[model samples]
Target: MNDHWENMARQGSRFFGKMTASLSHEIKNALAIINEKAGLLEDFTLMAEQGRGMDPKRLKSLAGDIMKQIQRADGLVKRLNRFAHSADEWVRTVELEEALALILSIAHRPASMREAVLEAEPASTPLQVTTKPFLLENMIWACIEFFLSENQKRIRLIPEKTSDGVRIRFVGDLPLPESSGLLFPGEAEKVLLRALGAELRMKPATGEMVLHLPKGP
Candidate 1:
């Protein structure tokens, strides 16, 4: 049990590190856009000072672009902050849709970079579960990373309530490998899911992966 927990801790650390790195890159890209826009605004002002009449529409457009990037950065930071706090508790009640949304947000940068679309199939009702939020999220990320690593173009998450608990279907076109090592490299994802009292199943024929989570810890 001690070794099991130690492994989880290590895995959690790696997940946090990878997520933070991706989030930082996203922020950097947003800042770069803002910087470029600001530079263009400065050039416009210089032209105005040189008696080159400024186009009001162009100035307004430039300002709008900068504001848009600022808003984008703000949203990313809020999501990153929420993710950072998920580690504060060992286990908590988490709304399934909300949790999955955060995972998708954090994974957006990498997914977009790979030109893969990550979407959640709309749920008619809320699915809530009590579990280790951070660990559960890491497990989801592991599954997503596996498919994204394989160059899969589209991944969809479908959440629904089960009689006993909740089920989240990870649907994509990439098939899961036969070997456990290939499906879950390093066995870290397996351990994390097991620790969360969740069951994972993959259908190679249909390229569907399912995660069954209990109602409570």
Candidate 2:
């Protein structure tokens, strides 16, 4: 592979690692809760065996808590699985709305870390696009990262179907940088845009940045 593609691959791998690490942490948290619950259950069992008596209601509540953790881990796994498979194909037809939601799911934690709320408004109808799914996610995440770095308090994403293409707009509560030209769509992002055959439009005055992705070629 050439240097450019190789760099992109390495970048994807890094992103994958970061996400998996975050997921593992979350899953671990759930597991730890379950373990604590198990210990309580064990305590209850011991009490019953010693004739000290155990509350059946407490046992039922503990079981429900364990079930909740299991369901949470299951959801995390499903999302991570979908994300991993997004890299399965170099290019494919992807439903834009589903893709947008997936990226937001994975990015919610990061956005929260920056004290920013990440919200999305889905298109009235599903928007489909032929593109590099992995790279496409990376680009959206790059936009999320950019907005998260801003002084803005909230970042709202909306995917719209346009006559010529699809416009994914990121709207913020505060004004985008007056010098967004200098800070955003950096060289790396430009490379990604070229790779995806996409365009980035920044409306700093309106606190909006739009990514225009063309339909299948």
Candidate 3:
């Protein structure tokens, strides 16, 4: 039992680190764009100081670009903050849709880098469950990373309320192999999911992976 807890701790730490690193890269990219736009604005200002006519439209466009990047950076930071706080407890009441949305927001970064689209279909109704939020996020992310690695063009997530709890279905172009390594990645992830009272089922014909999470933590 002690070893199990220790392993879970390590897994949680690794997941947190991975998420933070990805988020940092996203923020860095946004800042780079903002910096370039600001530099261009400075050049425009210099031109104006030299009595050279400035294109009002160009200046307006540059300002708009900077603002857009700023908003993007702000949103990324907010998501990162929420993710960090999610680990504050071992288990908590989580809104299935909101949790899935948060994980998708972070996982979408890697998908975008690979030129693949990752989308989450809005849940038809609110689905809430009690579980380990951080571990659940890690499991979802691993599934997404696997699909993205398979060169899937688009991956979709659909969350629905189940009789016992909630079910999140991951749909993509390719079917996941039945091998434990391909689906769960590692023993820690598999153990963590079981600890959360979650079950994963792969539907080869439908090209979907469905995760069934119980209502109680």
**In terms of TM-score, which candidate is strongest?**
2
Error of 3 at 127 (Å): 0.4
Error of model 3, residue 86, in angstroms: 1.2
Please give, for residues 44-128, the per-residue lDDT of candidate 2 as tens digits. Answer: 8888898997778888899999999999999988999999999899899999889988988888777777788888897888889
Q: How high a TM-score does candidate 3 get?
A: 0.89
Between candidates 2 and 3, name the one with more favorable TM-score: 2
Which portions of model 1 miss their true places by more than 4 Å? 180-182
lDDT of each: 0.88, 0.87, 0.84
Which runs in model 3 stand beyond 4 Å of their true positions?
Answer: 178-185
TM-score of every candidate: 0.92, 0.95, 0.89
* Order of the predicted models by lDDT, top scorer first: 1, 2, 3
> Least accurate stretch of 10 residues (summed lDDT) in model 3?
176-185
TM-score preference between candidates 1 and 3, better one: 1
lDDT of 1: 0.88
Please report how far candidate 3 places residue 117 from its true position, in Å: 2.2
lDDT of candidate 1 over 98-208, digit per residue (tens): 999999989987899899999998888978999999999999999888878767789999999999999899888676566634555456876887888898887766677
